[model samples]
Target: MNTNDATRATAETMPDLFALASSMEDDMHKVSDLAFLINDYLTRGDRITLEMQQALCWPASELVEVGRKLRAHSVALYAASKRPATLLNEETRP
Candidate 1:
């Protein structure tokens, strides 16, 4: 695939940030005991930010959360990609 096609494929596979965070249970990536069972998060760059993290750290959490979740949710995983588009004034306004 060319770069544009590759980019689209990547975008399509990333985790749905909203969905992963709302799931209370996790698949055990490794099992020993409850304490020892490591979910995907144990690998690092894994799991969604805590809800508290999102509330206090808007843009930073929003930015990094995408990649963290992409790692955790493996079946839906996608390599992270970035696009640089300048925002118009109205789009930038909060």
Candidate 2:
């Protein structure tokens, strides 16, 4: 596709991309909340298994990674959206 076509396509999809990222962020928050609940439960118990701690730690770590990636993607999207139209022109780039 031509540059204009590509730009139009990107513009059209930006909202959906942002929405999906936002949804993932919301899901990550839920995961964090669940982890907190699990920790609370474990603390109230007389004994906690290593495996149970690992179970909570793994998802929480994964959520942190996912959140990092989402933030990076959001930054990229914002940067792309802010680029001057001239920069997207084929003749303008080195």
lDDT of 1 by residue, 1-94 (tens): 6899766555553333334434423432111222322343345454443542444453544435544553466433221223221222233347
Q: Evaluate all candidate structures by whole-model CA lDDT and list the values in order.
A: 0.39, 0.55
Cα lDDT of model 1 overall? 0.39
Question: Which prediction has the highest lDDT against the true structure?
Answer: 2
Write model 2 residue lDDT over 1-94, tens digit each, in one string: 7989778867765664565466666546644645645455435443444554475564545545544665666676576466544453433346
| Candidate 1 clashes between residue pairs 3 or more apart in a chain or in different chains | none
List pairs with backbone clashes in candidate 2.
none
Give residue 53's lDDT in candidate 1 (0 to 100): 40
The stretch of ten residues in a row with the least summed lDDT in candidate 2 is: 84-93
